[model samples]
Target: MRNHSGHDQADHEGHGGAQPGGLSVSEHGYTLEFDSTILTAGVQPVSFRVIGPDGQAVTEFLSEHDRELHFIAVRRDTAGFQHVHPVMDEKGTWSVELALEPGDWRFFTDIHPVGHDGTMTLGIDVAVAGPYDPRPLPEATGIAHIGEYTVALDGELLPGEPSELTLTVSRNGRPVADLQPYLAAYGHLVALRVGDLGYLHVHPEGEPGDGATAPGPGIAFMAVAPTAGTYRLYLDFQHNDVVRTAEFTVRTATAAPKHAERHHGHHAHH
Candidate 1:
């Protein structure tokens, strides 16, 4: 499904899914392992493990961004959004505990081995039980690059029109330097409608599709907002042991005009 912007609250009243020992989403053979369940608006604990296309645990080999899996929870109608890190039980199993309202929701983990590009992934999904009343929201901006490795965005419907965005990167009051690669890609950016937090993991094309990742000198991506409204943007990059993130709000306008959270909290700098 092309989930580009804000998710409609009414569209998701009830939802659920089940899979154990990992379920396969792509025919190429990648599998997701997790013990999952559907719950009413309450506390939910879940675990996600990455098993390769060959069915082997490949966590240690993943890049700084890949070695550890992230668990983001958003309400189906797109209300509550939380960025969370799962504890790796050993080298393969990772777990997290969260409390959320019901509706059709998504949990995404985009990580890859240092050199395994195409193997990047999103591994979990669950349905929760609730009274199904979503909160109201203002239109959000799609993502845009506010200069200096900084990015922004806003999302709103321009039905039948295309949604295009430009992102620029700079650092320390300069155009940014070094640009080392992390997770086999030149810097990765993922977008999701804030309300539903659906995943729109995207990258600039022409990038090698091999297991090789891309480093950067400033990167930009173009995409179509499946629908439009308010969407949240997340960017991840590694300079060495550290993975830095710049997040902003952006919008998809039918006409001209536009522009857009991470790392305010005590995020351990790698």
Candidate 2:
């Protein structure tokens, strides 16, 4: 749909159909290939490459958000979220160390090849060998505490509609007004649907140098949920020259008739 950092994908070659990314391993003749799909649990090195239509590892890429590629790893149950950058060799093999647990994890790459008209996100699943115990999704909440900072979310996600979400940061009950720019913006937000792990990467409303934009207490974003369901949000922000992530679980707010609302309330109380 209307995803991808507030840009339309219709102009892209392989993005004719409007849909969220990270649901497939290959798209637009590009495939995400891993050296191995199975690994032992713990912090270890992982390697992978992007094979282009010509069946060669892609080496040239355009930078987006101040980086050539963005790597994301998360458990299938919407736990263990990590956003990190990996180093790519001349042969196009990307290497990074991840603290992986015993479970099924999804690895996503957001990249823009040199010749490609636009950026794309590709995903692959890997099995970490060991005892696997999946955890249930956490309950929805608006407040997230990371270290000594507190982040409060205000707004709702509406299905098939663009919703504005604002996150305010504070420390010890004082507003944080000196947030440094991370990835060319005040903050970066990543949203994944609970079931399919559909991905949406969004940036803030304005950039750091823009005169109208403030580095401050609230970062605003426009997000469109593909459907009515639960979602896990990860916000990466930088302050004091250090980056930190704040996590939150959110549910789409759907408008219902009065009687339906009453029924839902009654059912909840019963």
Candidate 3:
């Protein structure tokens, strides 16, 4: 397997190999260029392009989970998270509308070039001009309520290991059995480390059309935390033909030490 940097996955064997997200606007010879870095506080249109290693706008990209590009915008205070798909023109420029608020906002573009070896998530921060009152991050919890729906998260996130997470959706104290498929799965999850909003990839356990995967009250996913830290989770699901997102804050468990292996290796050297 290959990492976002086009390097062998082995490089990240014991730790995170790829550069931390939201720290740079470019990586792996690819650049994320925005039309304007400053904007007013309100709904506006944003545009950007991905420059390939050849210094030209990358016009071709493979669709991931039925989307060419996944654009995520979140406030620096871990608030106002939005996940939307942008349409790319022939010139390789992608444009999308966003509801902007005052404060520093981070933009993350998740894409995979047609011939690229692996998926890359490039991010940049933009300034929104206005009175900014940053909100505090909600306490870590396993339950989240959005509108009339309540989502119960059951799972533990362990550092360096894939942890199984199951989210059960309900409404009016009853299980929701008519969950619709979104992004080829019963639910789509995106995890971001709290402090820097580092993008953490969360994989769905199965597909909606798969005979074994049911579209019902429970959605299963495998999430691997890069390190032991607080993470914000955004779960996107569809019901009644409308898409809604449920947010949760979770802290990852500490990684177990490999003490026995280290002790044996130390003795063998003597």
- Give each model a TM-score: 0.49, 0.89, 0.88
Task: Using TM-score, give the best candidate's number.
Answer: 2
lDDT of 2 by residue, 54-173 (tens): 999999998887888999999999778989999999999999999999999999999989898678999999999999999988889999999899999999877665667999999889
Q: Rate the local accuracy (lDDT) of all candidates.
A: 0.50, 0.85, 0.80
Task: After superposing candidate 2 on the true structure, give the runs of residues whose Cα lies further than 4 Å from its correct spot.
Answer: 1-18, 256-270
Which ten contiguous residues of candidate 1 have the minimum total lDDT? 13-22
The sequence of per-residue lDDT tens digits that candidate 3 reaches over residues 200-253 is: 544466677778877779988755667778989999999989899999989987
Clash numbers, per candidate: 42, 0, 0
**Worst ten in a row by lDDT for model 3:** 8-17
All models, RMSD in angstroms = 13.3, 6.6, 4.2
What does candidate 1's lDDT look like per residue over 78-163, in tens digits? 45656566777657777777777777666666454444533333535677875677655534443334334454332333322333
Ranking by TM-score: 2, 3, 1
